[model samples]
Target: MSERRVLGGNQHALPASIFADDMSYVALGHLHLAQKVAKKEHVRYSGSPIPLSMSERNYPHQILAVEFDGSNIKAIEEIIIPRCVDMLKVPTKPASLDEVLATLKALPDDELPREQQPFLEVHVLLDKPQALLREKVLQALEGKSVRLAKITPHYSQREQQDSLQHRRLSEVSPQQVFALSWNKKFDGEPTEAIAEAFETLLTQVEEQE
Candidate 1:
């Protein structure tokens, strides 16, 4: 027997009864990461031909070949697919726009065809929107051989801290609120400098009011 959507956010479980000791092999799909299932060597996910997301850029995609001899598994070998295009996340985390541009400018010159050029995703950490965000990125890519797929901006400081004033009043420190709010929005924690800067901003705002 076989299954699909075992990965890609699908939570359905693969039944063990299909992988009885008598079974020789099972081919699976819907998971971008190739992996074995049910601790059975014969049951496996073929994964996608290419990485579907930036998170999977590190590993090479693969195809599995299973040889069978008289309904018994003979061999399982992996064939690595050549990357025709690349998916890269610059800095791997939130960083200054200049730092991100610097990284982009430092990339090895891409002389390949447009389709072969790497797909770059830039991460920019800012306090507010930059009106010329796309223009700035394009300027940085001048004379470069790459496709700028996206510029994901993360706000380091909360744009509306006052909204949390009444909700989390019990929180003792503004830094604590900043950390919590960041986690709530991005599902991740802020760095020490980011938290401290937010605390300083909160203090300044209080003084003004």
Candidate 2:
């Protein structure tokens, strides 16, 4: 099998058909969801023990318990893992500064053990930079039983197009150049995390000079 269409999606790797004749059970990894491949109970992916990224927040993380009798899989059971800490995106979806602030402030304030603290990602729908917006969110999260992860600022398409203006190439910094190029190619500003990652890499390169 060339392009193996598994339970998740089509994988370009080894086709499940190649192991069809093999009597041994195949346990695979890499895919994030625990599932069987090619409708075969023997071929499975246990998936990650926890959510690897924000996109996988809703994924049910579990361990697959396979009972083997001789060379065949007798039974396959999914063992659900208890979530020690929750991952929360304030207001669920991107919201205005006021709405995000109110939701952040209204979060569970009870002081729990550090290990039990939920991971929080603050999502703010911004058309333009709000003065001290991140600072205000941090202030609101103060004394709360949550670990602040990152502040995600989603810019509107109108705001992105508004930034398209001619500027002297030499007058702009590397970050500005990157932003301009990104906006021109993709028509949107890079996320805060992406910008920070580029900055970090830039700093490292400069240090190596």
Best by TM-score: 2
How does each model score on lDDT?
0.71, 0.72
Candidate 2, residue 67: the lDDT equals 88
TM-score for all models, in order of appearance: 0.66, 0.66
Which digits, one per residue and each the tens of the lDDT, describe model 2 over residues 70-151?
Answer: 8877888899898878887776667888899888888877989999888887878888988887789999888899988888
Could you tell me how far off, in angstroms, the CA of residue 144 lies in candidate 1 after the best superposition? 1.4
Residue pairs that clash (backbone atoms under 3 angstroms), model 1: none
How many pairs of residues collide in model 2?
0
Clash totals for all candidate models: 0, 0
